[model samples]
Target chain A: MYYIDDFLALLFGISLLIAFWKVRTPLFFIASGACLTIIYSITLFFISETKPVQDIIFYSMACLGCISGLLFIRVMLIRSISLHALKLSNTMTKNKKECSIEDQLTEQMTSEIGFRLDDLQQKGFATLTTDGSGQLTLTPKGRVIAQLVSRLYRAIER
Target chain B: MDTLFIVALTTCILLAPIAAEIVLKGRRLQSNVKRVAPLYIVIALCCITIGAYTHYPHPIVIVMYWCGYFLTWFGIRSHLESSILLKMLTTLQTSNLSRDELMSSYLQSYSTQSRIAELKNSGLLESKKGIISITPSGEKLLSIIDLLD
Candidate 1:
């Protein structure tokens, strides 16, 4: 019975990792991470007859594993080095003519800027304001996030 | 009781990376990952080996230590790997930067030619008849990454 419970815990833990790896956005990650953790913990609690300390440690390990998995996915997705390189390659496929590095570099920069602008608007961090002129302005939430990130940057450097 | 010791040890081991990040500010995020991530892996391996020999082979504790190391490393690496635009916003929190200036500065940081040369050297890219294409492995990797995005 005990071995079976351990097996179930391991199974649930692995499933949570798979879900995390499949997550592409931060919002999806948060929702799925919370749901999966709760389900895994509740299942483990009912099946395992371990001591409180053991149960806590098991739960903690599972949570940490999920977080680590999600973070690994996040880093891979956000890394622009390879993405830019791939984009350049794809661009070359469309243009049979020899392309210069500067052209690819410009395209990459434009793509990055567009991506960030889209993220800001989607997340409500920035807004488009028009009074016969289009301008990007940070929302209150955006300002707060910017400030928090700045503080975090300073702390990391320190 | 042994779990307590293992937890404490994991906490102490985790601090090593934080110290390394602070001490190695001169290194970029990519270089730091290469240097510090392996350090954590080595420490975790040492703990696992020692636990096996000490007759207190708690596999749960080993798992805990591995998770702890990963979390610590991930926290630092992800923060440092933030997009240049986000970093610009963060800097804008203190001082404003003109759009043209920001774009120029950010663009300067990227060297597409060098990056292409690197991919070619790694055999992920090849140019045939003046047309460049990704190798099979490169295509597979790009597709996987695209799915994630």
Candidate 2:
């Protein structure tokens, strides 16, 4: 019995060590909880005096172990949720303004529908400079309205 | 000798998890060692209560168990934290940023230039033109961080 216990304990210990060294976050917590629970239980065997007290103590330790494990898992879940929310916010923020401008430009150039400004230049929708830049930089009226719409979109998104 | 071996083995088992937790928690947050010590106390209390009721060994044996437990905990925790720090350094080394940009963004350190230089000298990173990259060994170290993330 002792040998089996020792062997299992050693195996558990080595696995725990490997988990630490590898630093795999998910395995790290699981391995830690397992090793701690096993070690506590085995060590208790050598220390407890009365059978009733021993049983009670072991049961409580098990409960504590379960709670600790649950807490660690809870923290992990919260961390992942917060990270996801941040990523979503960042993506929305970066694209929100640009998308609104694209929409407004599309609306103003109704004749060039389904065509990019660059494409329109290629199809002679507007003249081009020798350098191939578009002649019509959105007029101040277009620019101002586009900017306002973009601002409104951002405000609504937020 | 058998008793001592059992005691030592038990300690290792107990401490491994605590060490792992410490490392994970430490890397994610700027927590103090003192703040995390309570978890170990709770584990120790559990171990003691069970040990006392089951067979009640000598007080000295019990002390040895706790000492061993704490020592293992500290050792593993320190090792894991250093490993994580090393991984972060390796990632910075391999990133496509210029020395100044790398320092400002990923490294978030004032002395990132010197730090990158140090890593290069240590053979953890190699630089070409203005681009820096992690070496194979550095990549292996960084693999740990990648796995964690």
Candidate 3:
């Protein structure tokens, strides 16, 4: 019971990863994170001593756990798309060509990028234009999200 | 009052990286882990040292510290790097783009060569006599990534 909160938080994070293991989408991740957070919060209440300081600490742990889970899912999403590097490595490893890094570096990872664009379209950030031209355009929702991301990019640094 | 101080401390921890990115910009440290890890470590150490010195107050303070630490480290890394998808959408907002245009544009985040250099730096890959190959660590990393599928 000493650091039960930390243990519970770890549990919540694991539950989140399990929930996201199959779906691998933000909506699924969000739904699971929220549900797990609520369940854990309720469970914590049942077992907690309910001391003012103690309860505060316990709830804070749950909250942080939920946030960490959410952040982790986001990292996974980014890493998933960024696995173009992995794909490239796989390609090079499987290839017999003794190409220089300089030459191989210029290789086009078109399929992965195509998949990402298709994913963006599925997520409603962009859409294929209806003129049968297949031109991809951002939706209003996507514009807003893109704006927000751009702002964050400006606000922070690498 | 104690909670107030804890909240302030947590906020400071979360902001340290952004602050470092701002304050340390253009220096050699702005590169990557050299800058971010140091900030994260120093602040985490400060939190632990202070917690130990005070013999700890309420235990939830650990929650506050860890919450801030998690957000600061992973949050910043994702925000800085993972926003490639968002960056693509941002570019689209300016105008429609074919896949090639987007890939070949200023999308450094999606740039595989840079990513290779990064992984190479991280020891996931190695370059010899201008050739590139993956290390065993990189093979392990890809296998782990495969689990997500």
Residue A141, model 1, lDDT? 86
Each candidate: chain B TM-score: 0.55, 0.41, 0.60
Q: Mark the 10 consecutive residues where model 1 chain B has the least summed lDDT.
A: B91-100
The stretch of ten residues in a row with the least summed lDDT in candidate 1 chain A is A127-136
| Model 3 Cα shift for residue B125 (angstroms) | 2.1
Candidate 3 per-residue lDDT, tens place, A68-118, comes to: 645564565455433555556667777945655444444444555666777
Model 1 residue pairs with clashes: none
Q: Supply candidate 3's per-residue lDDT for A104.
A: 45
Model 1 Cα displacement at B38 (Å)?
2.4
Tell me, by DockQ, which candidate is best.
3
**What digit string (tens of lDDT, one per residue) describes model 3 on residues B87-136?**
68878878887666777663454566666666776777777667677778
Q: DockQ numbers for every candidate?
A: 0.30, 0.02, 0.38
Number of the candidate with higher DockQ, 1 or 3: 3
lDDT of 1 by residue, B1-149 (tens): 35655665566566766766765574445334556667667666766666556544554545554764566466555545446657656644543444554455555554456556656765667778755677776677678766767
Across B29-143, the per-residue lDDT of candidate 2 in tens digits comes to 2123445566566656655565555544333334344544455445433333322222223333233322223223422431234434545555555565544555665555445
Give the Å shift of residue B55 in candidate 3. 7.2
Candidate 2 is graded, for docking, as incorrect
How many residue pairs clash in all the candidates, one count each? 0, 15, 0
**lDDT accuracy of residue A92 in candidate 3:** 76
Worst 10 residues of 2 chain B by lDDT: B79-88
Residue by residue across A27-136, what tens digits does model 1's lDDT show? Answer: 77767767766776676666655446665465556576656656665765675665567656766655754765446666776677667656766888666655533445
Q: What's the lDDT of the predicted structure labeled candidate 3? A: 0.62
Where is model 2 more than 4 Å wrong at Cα?
A14-35, A38-40, A43-158, B1-110, B144-149
